[model samples]
Target: MLRYVIDVVEMLDTPKTSGASLAEFLRSQGAENAEIMVKTIEGEEGLSTDFVRVFIPGSRGKSSGGSAPTLGIIGRLGGAGARPERIGFVSDGDGCAAALSAAAKLLNMSAQGDVLPGDVIITTHVTGWAPTEPHDPVPFMGSPVDMETMNDFEVEAEMDAIVSIDTTKGNRTINHRGIAISPTVKSGYILRPSEDLVSVTETVTGVNAVVFPLATQDITPYGNDLHHVNSILQPAVATDAPVVGVAITTAVPVAGCATGASHATDIELASRFAIETAKYFGAGQISFYDADQFAHLVSLYGEATHLQTLGRTK
Candidate 1:
C-alpha cells in the first residue's frame, strides 16, 4: 500500500494528470475484469476535468451473480491542483490519491488472485487546474464542476456502503496530523461511529482512533447557503446507503488549496483503513450503523430525506 500510495501521489503531482492517463495506468495495473470508465467534462469557465471510475469484481460479487454487498470508495475533492493560483498538487488531492491508490492495490491483488467477497468501485475526478474560493480560517479549492455533477458520476446505485475520503485540514477542529473518521451518515441522519471501522483505523495506524465532529449541515446538499465542514459527506445526500468520511488531517489548520501539504505516510494509512473496511464490509463482517437502531429512530421520528434536497423554495 505504501508503494501504491507513493506511486499515485507522484502521478497526481503533475499538472498534466488527467482521467484518460489515470484510466490507462489502472488498466495496466491488473484486474482484467474491472470496468473502468473515463469521462471528460468541460466547466463553465472553459476548464475541463476527467472523472475516472473503476469497478473491481469480487468472487461473490453481484456482477458475478453473488449477493455480497458492493462497497464504494469515493475520493471527494474540489480538485487536485489550483493552477494560476497555486502550483503542484494541493493538499485536497490527498483524498483522491488515497482512493485511487487503494484501487490500484486492489487491482494488483485481484490480478494475483486475492479478490474480496463483494464488488468494489472506486471513483474520483482529475482536475489539474481547479479554481480557488474563499472560506473561513483558510481558502479552499473550487471544483471545475458542481457538486451534483460530481455525485452523478461518483455515487453509484450499486454501492451498499461508501467510504468518502477528503482532506479536512481547512478547519480548526480535529487538530491531529493523521487520519480521522467521521460518524456514519445515512439519509440525513448522523448516526454513531461504527466500532468495526474504528477498530480498523486503530489497527491500521497503530494508535487510538480519531473521530471528528459532524454537524447537521455537513450532511445536507451543497449550494443551500449553509456552512459545511467540506464535501466529505456529500455522498450521503445522493443515496440511502450508509456513508462514512475518512479525513486527512493536520496538527493545525491548513488551506485545501495549499501545495506541498500532503503527507505520504498519512495517505497510506487512510488508504489502508479504506481497504480494510471494504474487505470486512464486503465479507458481511462489519456494519456501518445498527440497522435496527436506524429503524427505531425513523419509527420514532419521521423521514429525514428532506435534508437531502435544496428544501422548499421560499
Candidate 2:
C-alpha cells in the first residue's frame, strides 16, 4: 500500500488542476504505479508551499509491475495573507473524492484486466450526527444521546453509457439531483437525453440467478422523520437473462447532518442495509464507494470480471 501527502500552494486551484500536476510529477519520479497525498503547508510561503509525497510498496523495481500497488493523494489550502483568524488552507473535499474514485478505477484496471468501456462506477456520500455525551461514570451524570442518524447526501456513478431517467412533467420531488450527475457525465459517450433519476437494472447472462431483498436496516427508522424511504432493486427476480457478467454499484455515506449528528453511525446503518439487502437478493458480488474512498467491489462467488459483450452485435 502506498500513502502520499502533497501540498498545493495555489489558493483558487481545483482538484482536477492539482491532480494533473501531481500525476505528471509521479510519472517523472519513475513511479510506475504510485499513490500520492497532497497537502498545503500550514504557515509556509511560495517555494515551500506546494509539496507532494509518494508511497510505493516493496523494493523499487524498474518496471511498474510485480506487486499490487496502492496510492493516496492529499492536498491542503492556505488561508489569507498573514491574518491570525483568517482561514488557512484545507483539502478540497470534492477533488479528493474524485481523485480517490479515479484511483479506484486505476487499481481495478491493474488488478483485473481491461475494464469495459461502459462499466459503471458508483460514488456516494453519507453524513450523520449526534449530540456529544459527557464522559461521566455515573448513570445520570452525562447528557442523554438525544438523536443519532445518517443521511445520503449524494450518490453518483459513471457507466459505459448514460440512460435518461425522465422526470419531465411529473412530480418534481422525484428528481434525483445527486444521483443524476454520474449518468450525465457518462451520457456524453452514449447519445441519450437526460431525465429524472429513478432506477437502474442490469441482466447478467452467465449468472444462474439473482435476487435483492430489502435489508433490516432499510425497514428501520433512523432519526425523527428521517429514513431511507425508497430502494430500487435491479433485476427484481432471478432470471436466466444471459448471465454474461454482473456489476452492482455501492452505496455511499453523506457528510454533515442538519443537526450535527454522527456521520459514522449513519454510514454504518446505510452499509448494513446494503449488506443485508445484497445477501438477501443473492448478489454474487458487492462493492463500496464513499467520499474519501472510491469504487471497489468484493466478489463473493466469482472473479472480478468485466462485461465485454455489452452493446455488441453478433
Report the number of the highest-lDDT candidate.
Answer: 1
Candidate 2 residue-wise lDDT, 248-299, digit = tens: 1113322111112112222222222222222222222222112121112122
- Model 2, residue 229: distance off in Å is 21
Model 1, span 95-198: residue lDDT tens: 99999999999999899999999999999999889999999989999999999999999999999999999999999988899999999999889999999999
TM-score of each: 0.99, 0.21
Whole-model Cα lDDT of every candidate shown, in order: 0.93, 0.22
Could you give me the TM-score of model 2 versus the true structure? 0.21
Worst 10 residues of 1 by lDDT: 22-31
Error of 2 at 142 (Å): 31
Candidates' RMSD to native: 0.7, 18.7
Error of 1 at 175 (Å): 1.0
